[model samples]
Target: MRTLVFLGLLAGFGFGQGPQATLPNLVPQVVSPPDFPPELAELEGLHDAGRYREVYEKALARKDAWGYVLASYAATNYARYQASDKERQDWFRRAADAAREAVKLAPGQKGTPSLNASVEAKAYFALGQALGRYVQYAGLFTQALLVNQIRSAFSKAIELAPDFPDPKIGMALWHAEGVARNICLIFGCRRDQVQVFLNAAEAQRSNSKRVILGYVDGGYANLLINDLKEAERGLTTALSLTPKTAEDYYEQERAKGLMEELKRRKGGSR
Candidate 1:
């Protein structure tokens, strides 16, 4: 599948390029916006209750940008957590397709203020996230195209809303994964920028589970670089957060798993 080439494309296209900043050692205190759409909030509640299939069905019924975006999140979570191996690929494809539709329906960011243009940012982020999950099982012939699409989606998301942290986190993960796979040897993956992106994201605190994921991804990036101290710090911060959604719970569990791995590595270094 020429994964090295794919990483090269991701770097050349400026996937992880963003503002540089230092992430504070503590999780930022933030609150969810009170003006959040009630209907979407209800779906998020259902998703938090772990009723992913229900949320997916209900969100899909709305047949709009917001609906499709939520549906994509639910679908991806269900596929990752509940779907059988045989079903995972199809579910991921469905998730990606739903997110793509959301992107199409979302208003363009041309004249819209970044904060007011969240729909397009969310839609593009979901599209990138879903395509990333799908690529794991996609055929080699399609994987290249999917990789490029994922990069484009996330890049557009960050461009549409520079303050949005999820896309920034996604970009950090892209660089971390490239470094983990030694793709930096091929394309100058710029592993240092991994922290740069994460730092920029952390500075924009939010109540969304995406912020928690930023920590998880940061821990993962540090883990990839064998920076155990920072890795443990990041994972610990992720674990300290209250899970506000099913995805948060899922990722915290992942954090725990990573912590165990970190411990093992630490012991091995003795």
Candidate 2:
């Protein structure tokens, strides 16, 4: 299957597309988002050479309008480095903000409503993902807070463009937002607070590739909640739906790890 063209669709998701874009033959000049000023090929070379940290740093420098694209690239690597919450959150927040800026700047003189709408969807979704990552590591309360942000991103992502793969949406709302809020309620999240983001993520089940990534993330969230059965199911499904593109290798490694863990648990039980 042709891997979906995922990057530029959102931020903080690590759908890196360095040279893939066809700079228009006719379009207004706009500076690329602020971020690490590395060419994609150089970054790719770094990644290929196993210099992941360098690649991440390179991406982190891109903090302009299309910053999310680079930030997402950075965060994807940061997650692997066992970064501290403060460290990673700072990066994620920066990336999300940059992505949002890209959306605002995306509307050039020639931009149609359709294009603007798509840009908004990507920006919001990227912000939500970045915030969600921060919330997850902060604590139960943080998780609860992040749920609302996640839903908000997905909600906007859907409202602007509601025609993504079904599983993508499912992960965002049904799994990421829904399960987190409900679980957080047991901790301290307010009822109304939970409803806002939960409803939004739930309302759309076809937001984007996020639905699938959400499921994968949802499984990890389940682990955070200590729901082994659910974690098993979620991770299993996540592995199944996970894409195999070079961009998806990080997730693929994670899914494989989850499978191994689940199997270990099952074997232990037996």
Candidate 3:
């Protein structure tokens, strides 16, 4: 997700003409998941192996809400790492479709207390993450068009599960990158929204991945905002966290590179 955010900022899009309406303040409802199912272990195994195609295939075979969410998640990552533009677009499209299916499978409306709301929230997160990546490679007009959808999906996920850190991280990237690019400034984004969401995500970092991502993404956001001190603090914290997976290690290396860049900038500034 941080990778997508950084790349998206580098591939900047054109801004719209005027101040847009503010996003609604949707209240989050507390919800909990049931006991962990055995199928998720298999999904995790496939994901860790980078067999996203197989993960998506197996997840769809489960014919359940969580299965659809897993498919979306896997497909999104697949698209993110794809080497071919056509293949990446196809996978992202599939990811969006699977995520919508997951939302449909999950019971209840937007604000209702349904048993499947948590899965629904996860589905939205996947959709937002995928769309965020898609915009990076899309045309300038397409990027402008999809920006609202990206914001809407992440905002809905946050509204559904405010305590969930991933969506907050996504939101922080949205605000930070948007501000850096001057794309969302007219939409009431002059204030520092990145730290607010990044702090929320950091507060809920319960696992190695979450802890690592919180710092990596927080540091990335700070870098965009030109807060060198905060960016250094965040990347430093990220490197200190123990990496428990390949993805975590990848982020650790990325953070290290960012730290090097920051040091060069600091030295140049002196």
TM-score of each: 0.80, 0.51, 0.77
lDDT of 1 by residue, 1-270 (tens): 576555444432212211112222322222253112555677766665567788799999989888888899889878876677788778888899999898898884222322454778889989998887787676654665666677788889999878777787777776676676665565345778888887888887562446566787788878877778989999999999876545566677778888998999999999
Which candidate model has the greater lDDT, 2 or 3? 3
Sort all candidates by TM-score, best to worst. 1, 3, 2
lDDT of candidate model 1 versus the reference: 0.71
Model 2 lDDT at residue 126: 57
- Report how far residue 83 has shifted in candidate 1, in Å: 2.4
lDDT top scorer: 1
Q: What is the lDDT of residue 230 in candidate 2?
A: 64
Off-target runs (Cα >4 Å) in candidate 2 are 1-70, 76-86, 103-117, 137-146, 165-215, 218-244, 264-270
- Residue-wise lDDT of candidate 3 within 1-270, one digit each (tens)? 854654455465321111112122322211122211344765655565456688799998877777887788778766644325568767877887888887788665232222223777877887887777667657755676677787898899889877677888888888877888765634345437888888888876652234675688788888878889989999999899765543455567678778987998889889
| Segments in model 1 whose C-alpha atoms lie over 4 Å from true places | 1-36, 108-117, 185-188
Best TM-score among the predictions, by candidate number: 1
Which stretches in model 3 have alpha-carbon errors above 4 Å?
1-38, 81-87, 108-117, 207-209
lDDT of each: 0.71, 0.45, 0.67
For residues 176-244, what per-residue lDDT tens digits would candidate 2 score against the true structure?
333333443332333343234333443543433234444555455455344567668767766676342
- Report the C-alpha displacement of residue 228, candidate 2, in angstroms: 7.2
lDDT rank, highest first?
1, 3, 2
